[model samples]
Target: MTAAERIARDFTLLLPPGWARIPLDGRVPLRVKNLVTERVADVPVEQRETLRAALTRELTAVLESAARQGGLDVLLSVAPVAGQPVPASGLVTHLAGQGNGDALDSLVGTLAAGSGTSSVREIGVVEVAAGPAVRRLTTRRERVDGQGDLPGGVLTVTQVDYFVPLPGTRDLLVLTFTTPIEQLAPPLVQLFDVMGGSLRWVTR
Candidate 1:
């Protein structure tokens, strides 16, 4: 199989058997719009569009940055449950070259040093189907800024980043999962690990 085909299959097989997939580029905008509408319900209807435009711009920028790092992205959504533990989901990014662990470590460290509200909790190498991967966990506590309604509300976020270098090709795969601290249970974290370990890059 060609590298592209191999990578496509790798992403498809990454998801657990029955999960549903969502196109981030297509759904993100609509989701963001809904969020803005719900959060700013008290605002004058006429001005809602203006507010949405601003919020969407900011959100799109952030997502775009991440998308660049992962040339291709895989996003998923699980079936609904009466009370789901946030329906665990993640983003996967693949690039046609290996990633540098030392550089990533330094970059993460630098980010932590500059941000008073964020910290790097752990950094190390772990084995995944692709090969040895750099794993880093980080924690950040920030206020929900633009949610005009939830003014000053603090939110703690936990994020795990995995940098996997394909066994044979100079390619790399980046996987990331972020969840609110309140919803990041041990079980969910374990599920993330298991899903990540199953990433196989077939080059045949």
Candidate 2:
């Protein structure tokens, strides 16, 4: 099997009850899941389909852009919890920056310390489905001054990075969960943790 296909099979998002999965067409299908009521009476299927279509449009652009840059492939998902105002989105990316562990670490450190970021704290080592991974926590605030659409003017963004080694390959499987801090709740956080922890490499 090809490397991208092999990496794709390594893990899956284990959606809790009331969640439904939607697959978006890309070079590969992007698997997406969202909190949905079992009964059609709760939220009409048409309404949900409309939302899914919109999300697919946005994700397609993001993934396609990433593809233009070498060594990055992604699987994207969207999950909207019951009470939360903003839904959670995820990206599991395979990036081959510098093509080595040490180079990847240095690149992450550089981004963490870069100008726009508020702070990038070292998370050190952690384990994922594939093997040991280096983690980092980064903080940034969105500004409305010259940006696209934001009436409120600012939103705090938090991103947790996991650099997982793809055995016998120079590429790194990057598991990243980025969400606005204020909108993040325990349940959503747990979802990210569970998905990241379940990552494991599959060999043919």
Q: 116-144, model 2: which lDDT tens digit per residue? A: 64666455666666667677666677864
- Mind sharing the TM-score for model 2? 0.63
The local lDDT score (0 to 100) that residue 3 gets in candidate 1 is 59
Give the alpha carbon lDDT tens digit for every residue of 1-204 in model 1.
465425544543356543533335556667656655554576688887786777568546655765565535544433334544244557776656445544555544544465455677877677777556777777788677656565667777777777776554555566777766545546656767777777666554
Clashes of each: 1, 2
Candidate 1 versus the native: TM-score?
Answer: 0.58
Candidate 1 Cα errors over 4 Å, as ranges: 1-14, 21-71, 85-87, 95-117, 146-152, 167-169
- Model 1 Cα shift for residue 52 (angstroms): 19
TM for every model, in the order presented, reads 0.58, 0.63
**Clashing pairs in model 1, backbone N/Cα/C closer than 3 A:** 1-204
Candidate 2 residue-pair clash tally: 2
